[model samples]
Target chain A: MAATTLRSVTTYDLKLAAPLALGFLVFFVTPLVILLALSFQADPQGSRYGLTQYVHFLADRFSLGVLGSTLWLGVKVTALTLLLGYPVAWLHQRAPGWGKGVIMLLVLLPLLTSVVVRTFAWVVILGRQGIINAALGGLGLIDAPLKLLYTDSGVVMALAQVQMPLMVLPLITALSRIDPNLADASSVLGAGHWRTFRKVTLPLSLPGIIAGCLLTYAAAITAFITQSLIGGGQMLFMPMYIYQQASTLQNWPFAAAISIIFLAAVLVVVSVFTVLGRLSRGYTNA
Target chain B: MLLTRRNLMQTALTLGAMHAFPGLTWAQARPLVFATFTGSWEEAHKAVLVPAFRKATGNADMVLDPMLSVDQIAKVTAAKNNPPIDVMLHDPGPALQAVAQGLVEPYPVEKSAYYKDLIPAAQEPTGPAPFFQVVGLTYNPETVKTPPTSWADLWKPEFKGRVGITNLNSTLGTGFMVELAKMHGGSESNIDPAFKAIEALRPSLAAVAANPGQLATLFQQGQIDISPGNFNAIQILKARGVPVEFVAPKEGAIAFKTTIHIVKNSPNKELAFKLIEAALSPEVQATLMEEPYLIVPTNTKVAMKGEIAKALAKDHAEIASKFVFQDWAKINEQRAAWIERFNREIRV
Candidate 1:
């Protein structure tokens, strides 16, 4: 038994884990570690390095404000998604037996298509010569074209539309887990329908909502191609700013510093989500 | 653990034997990484440019790394320590901006071969720094019944809302703005007047875009009445069944002669410069400019089949007189501040 325990894991291991682990270390971890390391170094001319790179990021007012913008967009997108998603999820839960299959297919359709194609569809619909503009123009709602494509409202609407499905799926799963008989019992016990929802359904579904919010916020904050394509180079959120730094400006240290700051903000958002989860008793850590 | 002990020893022996007799290895060891901006330009580079270069240089295992100019700049800057791209095709702003950032190294010229063949204006640095290509205004003839007689024609009420402008954040758009401002008697040093002028013309603008294809689409649909295009973009649009014509606008489009400098941080500078040397060659320069990807060549005499070079040459003298040569050396650093101000002032 002692000899068996003493044997090298490499000598006895039967899987290909070691080689794949090595590949991940070389490909993913090394690049990230290098970037993390370089973010700290200062490059005044962008030709050489010191610790001033971080100092520069810290020193710049815009870089500091990037957090607020990112968080504001994230929270707004999440909240809007939740408001729009809950009803759709409720509908899914309350669907008739025959309608269930069709609704299920409908709910999954947007997920099957590419985000870019969907966004382009929105662009055409929202464009000057597009459907909405044409319809609005015909109705004499506004004299001039309502500037819809490149506004904050446009960004939020588009973002929420894309994220609503993510919010709904998890919510439907959570809602499905709640026993309908429990709600019936609560109502029979003299609780109103609204009261039953407040007391049971909302509380029970909080886990999925929190998980979904975290996922949406994480995905929304890091968006690049979507924002670049749709933002019209005007409504630059933190991700767009970071991308311009990393890409357009070609300042890796500055870009990495911005990313590091963003990463820290994401960590705080996650921690807050965890705290919310724990306080509500809606999530299990395991 | 899976392999027998004998097999392991045999593997080691084979590896050792291969290492010992290196001359016996017939396989080429290096990967040819050629990068260019994405879209039709990339397709052309892949279809014709890279293949021709490979055939000429005898490099067969070449890989194309198609990316946006921004992405290419990032790679060149990030991999400043060691670059993946052996050759790259970039615009004037990025190429000049790279030089300003010290990401580019001076390209040594072969006096007789390069100096004698390059156009007088394109042969030397146009600004405080050197550039890779001379950029100017190009419009399609098929779209214009009466071709724009002057640079100021873009602002005429007839072309209102049919003109596609680029994003102000980009060098291309900013360059266009600066040129327009100069036509209206303002300078890049005071870009405010230019911005105000552009704002006044916003009603006439179709869209502020970067994609050449978007402009092409507008032209194809007859939505774009006029386009302020790059010399190559005009050529690309014409090839795609778009009724387009190019002009050297009356006040003359700005002339930005570009240079092909070796990226300072590239790992394979020796091979890169050889490619650069090929780029400098009159034969290659002429080929790049006169064919499917019709860029204006810097070389004085490459060979223009018939009307191609002459068409490119039309209005050359007129556009040259009033051309605004941008001072990238100073402006490159101030670009961020200019862009910030532009963002604050420009309507979203």
Candidate 2:
């Protein structure tokens, strides 16, 4: 009799969950499913419904080049941010009293401001008559101004500035979590401070590095407005291409196809990172 | 150097290749939807057309949809099998693209009535489709002290960083250039010098806007003291007592007569056609002109000798003498290639 009551309760729970699952299918699952279906479609006026649209986007030489550059920048941004962000994170970790407050403010400033506002600031700094050139010219430092605004270097610089907050926060968390005794143990055993840090602290902090790199790379690849305003006609990224296809051209299938391609690319990157981390023997409980 | 006044149509001319979704037929009673854009078009749609359309139809429920040009295109194309919009106020190129691709059906406008009321250049002597009304350079007189009397005045170094112009691919920008070319030893016949001169004036161009409104806002702010503009913003400025004017400079900004067409597979084809008829009617067109004189209707009976029209055509006599409208259909075919090359080579 008690077992029967338990079975009835289990059935009641699933009955309630059925509607929620259906709702999920209706709202979230439907659009994604439709997009997947349409990604394959191609018609004369637009995509009708086939693998043709995806094939068309993939087949283009221009799109392939854009894909290559986009993927490269994603990796570059991730690596560069880790290099810059790790030091700031360490400073924040080792900071004392008043130093901690200042470091916290510095880290959070970029997060508090709007992305568009921050990007516009970069524009003024990077433009032809902007601050850097003015200072250089005023000092009689150079004859000609540097072409800094629209180049690939400009893209990376702005991207790094925007993504520093993401990289630093995770790393700081990881570094602070390290046990003080592990360092003392190495020193007690007559290991020098540098050796102890190299053998212990550095290896321990890498998981945070991986996590920060993952977040930064994902954010950088998806950045649209910053690249759009600065790049203009000069540089073309994946998001911009998707915007043009979806908005300017009104090719839904093409946009969907490109988005699917981008999603696949990201998954592969994430999978590779996971594999590499596993190979490094990250079998730690903490 | 195909010296046309606009970009080549990037929209592919692939017609009737797929069957579209016919959601709700016009035979059924559903309110017709008109896709309106932001700024002048939005104001006109809201204040003028919607009310008139509702009163005329007596439904009091005419639907107005707001989307950017590209978004609207996406919506229309996304719902290609089943279209939501019946009527559109789209640019000529997209309209032409739609017509060629069979997204829109031929709107049986009386060729004689449309052509007779319009400047000759707007007639589609060659292309499969002709859509979009032509708009040109309108400016504010209070701000433009020794105002631009011709296209040539815009190139002066005095207005450097004080002048606003649209991107080259836009109809008005293309029109402005064609006018300059005609005056500076290029013509509908020869356009090389015009390209050369435009390249020279790139240094003087303060900003390149996507449309005239951005240009107008900059002009109003004193960031830009002069602009090569369209008819709508000048009228809005004059309404607000901003001392704006529209010049016909000897090379008149190219004028193309516009049209409204039905999408072939639209579920709302019947209501769409009726709504279009109302949009193009004497009442609605006149209403649009009342606040911000956006369009001088193709209807000859509108009798546009009003205070607004006179104020808008600031230097009418001078512009009338020199105005030369380009043949748009012929130019539309070659515009994309020329614009691409100009952007690539001459934007130094």
Candidate 3:
């Protein structure tokens, strides 16, 4: 009787899961398979198949430079988001009632706005005669307006703000999951508040930190709009380069090859970071 | 007449056939599909050209699909056997590429009544250009007391950190590059002199604006005193009382043509040709040259007066003598490599 019931339950689970599995096959797996095949094609129309595209990308110095810039941007954005998000998450975790709600709302506000709108706002704020320069000039900080737009720092600043929410939500969840009693017990044992936070709270929040970093890093690397708007086409990142190649130049084969390389590079970086994160967590726990 | 299952199935089948063959049901009506620019260009066409074309041809059914030029080309190329677009409006570069790729059919010169009236420079073997926009030096009159007379004046010491330039990815940038190449003894084949000249002007540049809007904003905000840009953008800003002036430099401005072409294998080729003809007609051209659309009419038959005359090229002679045209087909091949090189070497 028990075995029959178990078999029925298993069948029901499969029936429920079928739609999602089918969706993955159709939407995700199919496109990826097509991309992989196209990456090997010799021409834009895919009339012939060869490894020429991949070989060209590997040999091209411009392609390599773009790859380096993309990786660097991803790292910078990840670090900055973590630094800004961690404190906001900690404060929100400690806030009482209405305060918590307000912080949460503020954290989610940027996410509510369109990425394009947010990036444009940054353009307005960072331009030569923009708000920052105006204020600085008013205060007599300098005689000349500093160049901000069309620079790497401008791209990083916009991307960090755009990706802040992804980092904060995971962090807040991780911090909330830690028992308050652990902090109380540490305090009772005469540990200072700072020490208690450093030892207990920080270690407990490792999972969330790692999750947020990975998510933000991945997004930063693939970001197209922010880089395009802020970089002003002067700061060439991989995604922008790929877009130019495919659309303006109509070099689909080259674009596909670049995309494959970009995906591989992202995977390798994420894997290395994941292993490092695990090792750090283990050490902290011990 | 009876409410039987077989009768119901037959009725459903009949309805489905009607749905699928709506055009067939109405043999006299088939909508011509045209792919064109979005925003103001689309608005201008809908307001004037579409209705005028319909009235002239006695075909009231037409559909305008607004998309970016690249997207339009991609759609036509992807659906080569049966193109979704009957007519396509694009810049000269993409139009040449479309013709080269066999995505578009050449206009029938004999069929067009206004073809002879079109400015000789506007006449292309592939198609007739309906309008042209010139790119030259634009500056803030308030900051620039003495107007810049030449393109080389951008690098003058007084304009240091007060000039804005577009990156090489844009048409304006490409034009600037060509102008520089010409001024410094280099030509189309060799742009090395142009690169050196641009590198020298880097210190004077406030920013490399990616688009015209950004350049306009920079001018409005007094972030830039001078920049190389198109007359249309400068005119738009001047209309808004932005204290900007468009200057035709001594070395002539780059004239970029906006052209229309009939897509190959179009189901409505005749209607498409008619529409293109209507757009190029003196009546339609004159109306489009008015406010909100300020496009320079290519038809010599169209008369201009007042501010429009001052804003546009004086006549066919001026257009022939003052405007510089590039070999877009040849330039497009090396454009990507040139842009990458510009970003790496000159921008740095």
Candidate 4:
């Protein structure tokens, strides 16, 4: 009787999960399979299929530069967001009722706005005759307007702002779950505030930091519109390169090859973060 | 109470008649899907061409599916066997690719009444060129005391860090590259001179705009005093009270043709043809040329007079003498390599 009941429960659970499994198979798994297959195909109008696309991407110096720059941009944006977001998340956790609500709203406001609008706003703020330049000029701090738009710094700044909310929300969730007594115990045990934060609070927040970094880094690398608007196509990131190859040039096979490689790079980075998070958790428990 | 045998028979007859004559229902069932430019371009078509097409064909079921040219091409390519779009509009470069890929069929020129009236250059082997956009030097009159007479004027010492240029992804950018090549004793096959000239002028570039809208905004904000762009965009900016001017450089302007194509194996092939014919008609051409879009008409029958004519390339003589055309097929083949090189070397 016990065996039959267990079998029935397993079958029922499978039946309940069937829709989601089918959806994943049809939507996600199938397209990825197609993309992987397309990566090996020859360029348009070429005869037969081979590894020509991948070979070309590997051989080209421009492709390698774009990939390296993309990874660098991802890292810079992720680091900037963490530096700015951690404090805001911590403050939100310690604030009083209404104050906490207001801070939370402020943190979420940017995410609620359209990315294109935010990017354009950054363009206005960062242009040669933009507000910063105007202000500096008015005060006689500088004679010449600064060249801010269409530069690597411009792209990084815009990306960090866009990806900050992603980092803050995750950190807030993790930080709120920590017990206040742990910090009190550390303080009573002769540790300074900074030391307590660095040893106790920081280690406990590792999972959230890892999650936030992974999300922000992946989003920064794959971002197209913000880079296109601010970088002005001069800063050719991998996503822009992929778009140019696919849409403007109509070279789908090469684009597919680049996309597959990008996917692999993202997966490797995410796996490393996950392992680091696990190690940090083990150390904290010990 | 009315369910007598005679009443029931009368109701049955009415239902049979409704099925027999499905004129209204049939027309409503299949709307002709046209994929074309978005924003003001789509608005212009809806205002003029859609009504004209409906009047000519007596078919009121036509839908305008606005999309970017690249997105339109992708959609048609994906659904080649049963294309979602009945008609497609694109620039000459992508239109040639579409023809080569067998995604579109040639326009039936013999069937179009306005075919004879179209300028010789407007008719293509694969599609009909309905309009032309002239790309040249656009400048702010307030800042640029002397109007630029040639493309080389942008590299003057006084204009350092004041000039803007579009990115290589756009047609205007490609045209500017070809113009530079011609000015420096090179052709499409030999673009080294062009690259050298652009690199020399790199220090003068204030920004490289990603799209026409961004380019216009830069001009409006006075961030750039000079740049290479289309006449239509300059005209629109001028109308909005921006003191900008478009000049035909001594080296000549590049004329890019906009092509209208009928997607292959479309369900509404006949309606699509009629729509293309209507777009080429003199009335619709004049409307497109007048305001908002400011497209130069390809139909010779439409006589653009006054300020609008002065702003555009007028007549065959002006077009032949002052406008340069590129082999789109060859340009398309080399575009990716040139853009990659530009991004790595010049734009850096």
Candidate 5:
């Protein structure tokens, strides 16, 4: 019993993580608790404490619409990133050793540049007389420029590009971990490339897909700079909405309430992904 | 001399404590931090104002911590007892907000050497306006053959899909809305006409930029031909070889007074007053009004010249006649509701 109870070499003492835990408590948890308390105030002046701010947000159609649209934007961006990122991940996995390095560098290239720079590049690309419109106009495809810069499609496209690295890297890790012999074995049993991919390769990469989607989804929603820059002022997301309330209006209680609501909404989505990840783990093991 | 482990530990802790709590060292006073706006404002102040301030104060140690007006208010409000900023710069809207929040000290009018030399509009007991930000019609000279003379020209069919404006989160945006409302028979309390005017401008709108800064980029990209833009911002863009020109609309140029104040509980209050005094000086104001900066001066003694005289107004009397200063106190009262309404309504 003593032999069995002896500490294993692989296990670390809980005391080793005490400093980090203490830091998290002081910085992160303490601030969050304060924010939660602040949100209960009825007014910016904190004259009364109640659920007025929450009610004010939840009851308002405009506020709910902003929240809905922000969440929907995340869904659209995550979907686009996954759709575009999956092929690159697959290609990376299938590449030769040197080709793998080249593909990795290309995948990681966007991450090196700042998000603001990337967003601005998107602005230049999506403008009325921008590269796309210029190319189209030169080819005599259209007489007038298409409105792309401030549109929903413009925001989705930009966000997808900015967050592409998050989706692709995780996918590459998952795809590389799959056994090369399994695909060969599936083919030997008379399955086609698409069939083998759907059955064997696809299921194996589900965990990575879930993780990538989670990261991209969360990032695309809270990305204040990219959302504001590419999405334009007219397009109000949760981040901008919070900023408007907090900074512009100085309604701290309302801003805090909105942020807490946004946080709760994000957590709900993350939990759904977490459950899927657990199921994917079981499926991959089986 | 032995360098014992116990002695080494004591030395390390002493150093750490001194680093953490800097007040333990009583020999040094903290640098007098002046929170100014970023970009060209910082550049202009660093080049002209800082040098002038140092010269006046016998080479006093000061730092220019550039940030937005709201951020300055927040930092000062967070530590009211011991404010980090000795001085703060604010637009008309935030200047009132700061005063209401009791974040700033009232200007010592009796003590100031140059306060009486300023224009009547520049004199405020809370904080004195050292500079004016003029908002006028900014258009691409290359694209716009005939320069826009009125704000109403934005709604004209000829400018279809060639105009840009910002949402009402910025001073420029809010001021523009107030101007529009006034043009359409509405006052500061009544913003309904402005919303109606903006509705009419929907057909002509190309991009509603996130901020005034984005408007410059939009002009560069040829995404927008015309918009109501700040004079200084337009000058900066034009200096960078962008085909943009500033013109005072026939109605009037919107003037926003950028006020400077000492933080309420500032330890460097004396130095802060000295710096503000330097800002209000004709020498500093005149230099700032010159090329590259193009910042409008509030000091009547400065005598507006060069680009400011050419583009904005000829003299202080002309400035009074041509520039329309809005009631920011009234605007600030219902700005929150207006912002909410704009969020709900404005979309192109």
Candidate 6:
């Protein structure tokens, strides 16, 4: 009787998920399958199906360079966000109950606006005669405006700011889950603040760190608007590269092949993060 | 009425189906969807063309679904039998692509009252050109004291770190490159000189804008003093008090025929014809040629005035003499290669 009830409950739970499961199958999985098939076609006309598109992308040095730069850009943005986002998360944890709301609102403010609007603001801020240049110019610190916009570092900075909430929100959740007594226990045992953080707090927040990094990394790389607007035309990241090929050139086979390769590369990166997250979970519990 | 589970389920399912596919409720007689270009084009059409179209068809149910030419082609190609859009607007490149793909219906020349009245260049059998998108040199009047007279001024040492150009992804960018090639003894078939010229202009380039739209922003920010800009786009900026000026170079301003087409297999073919007819009519074209819109009218009967006449050509004969139209068919053949080379070579 117990076994039957248990089986019925499990089946009922799954049945409840039927609509969403069907939605995924019809909308998400089906298109992905079609995209996969489209990637194998030899030409835009799809007269012959073969490995030609993949070969073209893999053989070309420029294509590979674009892929590498995109991945590297994700890495830079993730690292920057983590470095910057950690303190805010820590502050939120330590903030007196009422103070937490203000910090949270400030962090969430950027996310409230459209990414296009945020990116254009960055464009204005980074331009030759922008606020930063004007400030620097007024101070008589420089003869000319710094070439801040349309460069690699500029893109990374803009993306980090744009994707900050993705990193911070996950981190806040993780940090809140951690007990405060652990830090106190470390301090009473004669560990310094830095040492306590490294040994106790850091290890405990590993899950949050990993989750935040994964979310931020994914968003930063796929941020087509921010990437193009900040990086400009000459930068040529993977998203823009795909857009140019697919939309402008109308070479769908090559575009699809590139997209598949990008997906695979992203999967590899994400898997590595997941493995770290799994290990961190084990470490935290132990 | 006692609500049984069976009847409740039946009602819910029916409602869900209706919500999911509104077409199921509306049946086959949907509005005529015309996919015009986004931004200023959409604004112009919404203000002028749509009203004209409505007046012609006695308040026909129509919609202006604005998007890029490439997007328009993609949507039509995706659903060839029952296309979502009835009409499409295109630049020179995508216009040829649409014709080659057999996505455009040949204009009913015998039926079109205004087709014969259009300038010779605007009269296309597959899709007639309703407007001309002119590309010329745009600069900030405050910074650049002397008005640039030729394309060569962009390459001058005086403009170092003050020039802007887009990559070959846009019609404006590709047309600019072809014109550069021509300046250096190359033509539509060969683009080598253009690459060499860009390489020479590398030092002067302040920003390689991702699109023509970005160039306007760069100008507002003072990131670039000058760029190869569209006439209509610059006019929009100037109206916004951006302190920018447009000039037709001695080499000639690059003109792209902005063609409108009837999508093949359209359900509302009759309405689509009426819309195109309204677009080509002198009255509609003349209104579009006025201030703010400043759209270059291709109808010979629509006398040029205001910004269009002052900035572009004064009359039809002057337009013929001044405007340099390229062989887009030839350009389209090697466009992919040019874009690839551009992606590889041009980096700021």
Best by lDDT: 6
Q: Please provide TM-scores, in order, for all candidate models, with all chains considered together.
A: 0.78, 0.66, 0.92, 0.93, 0.96, 0.95
Off by over 4 Å in 1: A1-37, A45-67, A96-98, A138-144, A282-286, B1-28, B73-82, B97-108, B111-115, B121-164, B180-227, B234-248, B255-292, B303-312, B315-325
Best-to-worst order by lDDT is: 6, 5, 4, 3, 1, 2
Q: After TM-score superposition, what is the CA distance of residue A198 in candidate 3 from its true location, in Å?
A: 1.9
lDDT of 4 at A141: 97
Residue A170, model 6: lDDT of: 90
Candidate 6 lDDT over B191-257, as tens digits, reads 9999999999999998898999999999999999999999999999999999999999998899999
Runs with alpha carbons beyond 4 Å of true place in candidate 4: A1-12, B1-29, B314-316
Q: Scored by CA lDDT, what does every candidate get?
A: 0.66, 0.65, 0.84, 0.86, 0.94, 0.94
lDDT of 6 at A253: 86
Model 1's CAPRI class is acceptable
Q: Which model is ahead, 2 or 5, in terms of TM-score?
A: 5
DockQ of each: 0.23, 0.13, 0.51, 0.56, 0.84, 0.83
A10 Cα displacement, candidate 1 (Å): 25
Model 1 chain A TM-score equals 0.86
Using DockQ, give the best candidate's number: 5
- Top model by TM-score, which number? 5
State the TM-score of candidate 3 restricted to chain B. Answer: 0.90
Error of 3 at B304 (Å): 2.7
DockQ of structure 5: 0.84
Candidate 5 scores a chain A TM-score of 0.97
Model 1: how far is A258 from its true place, Å?
2.4
lDDT of 2 at A70: 86
Candidate 3 Cα errors over 4 Å, as ranges: A1-3, A6-12, A43-48, A276-286, B1-15, B27-30
DockQ-sorted candidate list, best first: 5, 6, 4, 3, 1, 2
lDDT of 3 at A133: 92
